[model samples]
Target chain A: MRATTIHAPGDIRLSDVPDPALSAPTDAIVKVVAGAICGSDLWPYRGAKAITSGATVGHECVGVVEEIGGEVRDFRPGDFVIVPFVHCDNTCAHCRAGVQSACVNAGHTRSGQGEYAVVTQADGSLVKTRGVPHADLVPSLLTLTDVMATGWHAAVSAGVRPGSTAVVVGDGAVGLCAVIAAARMGAEKVVVLSRHEPRQQLARAFGATHVVADRGDAAISAVEEITDGIGADAVLECVGTAEALTTARRAARPGAIVGYVGAGHGVEMPVRPMFEKNVGLVGGMAPVRRYLPDLLDLVLEGAIDPGRVFDLTLPLDKVAEGYRAMHERRAIKVLLQP
Target chain B: MRATTIHAPGDIRLSDVPDPALSAPTDAIVKVVAGAICGSDLWPYRGAKAITSGATVGHECVGVVEEIGGEVRDFRPGDFVIVPFVHCDNTCAHCRAGVQSACVNAGHTRSGQGEYAVVTQADGSLVKTRGVPHADLVPSLLTLTDVMATGWHAAVSAGVRPGSTAVVVGDGAVGLCAVIAAARMGAEKVVVLSRHEPRQQLARAFGATHVVADRGDAAISAVEEITDGIGADAVLECVGTAEALTTARRAARPGAIVGYVGAGHGVEMPVRPMFEKNVGLVGGMAPVRRYLPDLLDLVLEGAIDPGRVFDLTLPLDKVAEGYRAMHERRAIKVLLQP
Candidate 1:
């Protein structure tokens, strides 16, 4: 099977790789239907993260179950499922506490690693739709696997509530989706801080009451103005950059929560100011397993179309182009059909 | 009128100063019945925080209303009252939200500045006991003004629950009082990290179920061992040091809350670790005005004795010795009688 591989910085290529097969009793093999490029994938593609030559790349995907090991009970061959980026045995203590990202036995499952992917703890990790979703809905549903759930976690961790004001600091697909999640959670006013027109438009479609094309001080002031000079009740730091984190902190009101889900990029917490404002900081990786069911329901019920984040699409053979489009900021997200 | 003043890093003197008089329509003059040293006070006495010569020092006091301005209707002369270290109008939006420490019109009212101190917003800042209490209860009741309320804030912010395990970082008066507060809040197990014999004894007396003399890794191990390796449900960071903050962070279980009341000093938030563990950090200066009434009731009911923190007492003339004693680590706290 052909898969995308990163041999070095700026050197993404399509190459032949072994198809995955069930390696454990609880595992299931899935044929990739659709895979999406992630911001985190940029880490290794840019050589910022350690990526071995010919290493598998993508972690977000929607796939069809091809085979199940003896222990797999909830899913079988031909089932369409949304696979969370992190695989977890839903029965673990952390998973039971709704923190699936920290599940004791959690592991990363990437579609780009192999055309046929082995999903561990199949019963707990795969969320099966009522049936095979229409091909057009695949991209949106694929998001439930990672980006959408991450956005949901950002909003939930920030304690966004009805009548609350929220500021999402990132123009990435995750940030755009965060605007949607905050709105769904009943935030009275959702402010998206982004300069990219595509992301800003999606943010508006996702119910952002206002969009500010500014960074840091200007962005914070815009939120404060919208919140009657009180700043936002919640600030979602979707960008892992130091600048984005600072903007999130500056935009939150005293006693407000700042939910940061970005992979750290040398962002030093502004402790003194955070302390003065009594702001609570909470968030990390997306607990997609815990949120997949509800988000999938939202997608199925047409409550939100998070897949709108994908602006570019390509065949799996052109996966290099998909990564390039995202890296160059020409697309918010890229969908690759296998 | 006589008042305690700091002349230098190690010199505290009691001398005649102009008696405080109402400067604003909302002000009331209070004759201090008792005032105690606070952990923060040591910052200046030990030269960690600069002090101007002749500056009044103490911020925690219990006093009797001596005079009231024309606008002060709720408080009258001769009413015994508990004065929160910070005076708040209690009508600001922040105060309405129960964060009085951030009240828009809050100000520090310290007895060290003068014998008769002016308390702003007498109607909202002062909580009076129904009547004058016996002299023996003055010291204990006086604690409601600061340390006790701060301790309560720590426990409350930490989300202490019945049957929850609580870990307290710091062995100062606030930490000792936190043990009492956690117990009062119904935490099943309260572990206090204290290496000092006097503080450990005080912690036990205040209802700490376990006293660990370790810090960092050992302290975390001790707490995990006590909780069957699950970690504590709530952690109270009463020490402002970075080490204490890290210890507190390491002590809580996922989804647990860490309430920190320490005036943060050199505390660097380990953002990634905190995010990975799903820990909630909530803390800042305690909103004493919000907790003074309930803490006073607890003291009045004889359910807690917070004054045990004061290990030394002295007349106003020996104010220097009180500061010296605390700075020298010879006393946990000092009570001054004017």
Candidate 2:
């Protein structure tokens, strides 16, 4: 099957790779129906993250179960399911505590970035839909696999509630979805930091009450100004840079929770400031599996339209262009028909 | 008036400094009754944090209102009060949210280490006791000024609830107090990680259900073993270091909160493991004032005996010896009487 593979820095290609097959009794084959490029993918695509040549890419998808091992009892062939970025047994101590991203049995789950990918612990890793989803809803349902669920994780972790004011930093797909999630969760005023015109417009459509076209100190000043200098009741940090983290914390009221869901590297909390502010730094990898059930319901009921995050969609063969579009900020998130 | 002064590295002296008087309308003179050495004070003593030779030292104390500023309305002469380590206006955004340690109007609080020190923002920084605490309870009340309150901050920040299992790292006075605090807050099993025999005994006395005399990986293993490998529900990180932070997170169940109170100078979260664990890191300079009222009540009701933390007591002239005892590990905490 032809799948997205990275041959070198800035070189993503649709290469013919060996088809996936069930190697373990608990594994199942998922025929990728729809998938999306992730912000994290840009790490290696832009040469920021060292990637071995010929490595299969992608971690978000929705697909039909093509085959299942005997041990997989909950899902069967032709069943539509959401494949979360991180797979889990759903029974580990971590999973039971609603943090399946850290499941003890997570390492065994194979990545689901290609055609006919093998999913481990199929019963726990795949969330089967009640029925086949409509074609128009597939893109939105696919986000439950990672990005949309991640935004929900950010909002919930920050304790966003009705009547609360929130500020979301970053204008990527996840950040944009965070504005939607915060609004869905009932935040009265959702402020977003977006420098792009399209993102700002989408943010407003996603229920953003204010859009600050600034970054760093200026962005913080704008947020503070909007918040009457008291900062927001909740702050969502979708960007992982030090400056973004600082602004997020700076944009939060004392005792507010600043939820961050970026794959941050080499980031350190400025001890004195965060400590003195008494802010709670809560959030990491989204326990997407934990929130998949609720988020899927929201999409099915048309309560949220996360598919809008897919500003650009293309066939799986044009995966390289999809990566470039996202790299150049020409797309908030790219959807692919595999 | 005599006070402890750090002249240079390892150069602590009992220097005669001019007496403190109200310089601001919001300041009041506190007649120092008792003060204690802090783990953070060792930073400058070891030359890690340079100190000016003639600078007054110490931030913890309980004292009498020897003189009140014209604007002071909370107390009058002869009134006893608990002076928190950091002074605040108690009305700023941070202070209003119970983070007085980060108060915007906190530039005036003079350290209460000297015989007579000027307490800034007296109405907001001083927590007056209902009455003069008995002599036997003064030591316990003094801990409320910082250490004990700091421990309470750790437990509260970690969301310690009834039936929760908590692990406290570090055997310092603050850690011991955290054990007491966890138990006081109704943690079903409070575990203290300590290597010393006396400290272990103190931990148990302070209501620790178990004591693990190990550090680092071994300490985590012991904590996990005690919890049937499930890890504790909450972790109190009284020790501020990368190793301690890592162990605390490792010893916690996924989705658990780890509260830290040490003055962390240059610590950064080892991003990946922490992010993967999905743990929440909450803590900082304890909003000591926020918990002072409740802690003092517990001490007055004979519900907690924090005075036991001060194993050594000396006259003001022997302040240097007090610092020496704490630096040499001869005492968990040293109380200096003025």
- For each candidate, the DockQ is 0.55, 0.63
lDDT of 2 at A223: 79
Q: Which predicted model would earn the best lDDT?
A: 2
Model 1: per-residue Cα lDDT at residue B189: 96
Worst window of 10 by summed lDDT in candidate 2 chain A: A107-116
Residues B1-338 of candidate 1: C-alpha lDDT, one tens digit per residue = 88888877777778787777788889988888888888898878777777888877788888899999999989899999888888889998778877787777888876633466778888878999888999878988878888888888889888899988899998888998999999999999999999999989999999999999987798889998998877888999998878888899899887678898888755567677777787878878888888887777888898999889989988867777887787777888888887
> In the order shown, what is each candidate's alpha-carbon RMSD?
1.9, 1.9
Each model's total of backbone clashes: 1, 0
Show the lowest summed lDDT stretch of 10 residues, model 1 chain B. Answer: B109-118
Candidate 2 lDDT by residue in tens digits, A1-338: 87888988899888889888787788888899888899988888888778888988888888999999989899999999998878888998889889888888784323345675777878888898878988999989988988899999999889999988999998998998999999998999999998899999999999999999988888888878987888889999898878888889898887788998987777777655677677778889998889999898899999999988898889888998999999999888998887
Q: Best-fitting candidate, measured by DockQ?
A: 2
For candidate 2, please provide the TM-score of chain A on its own: 0.97
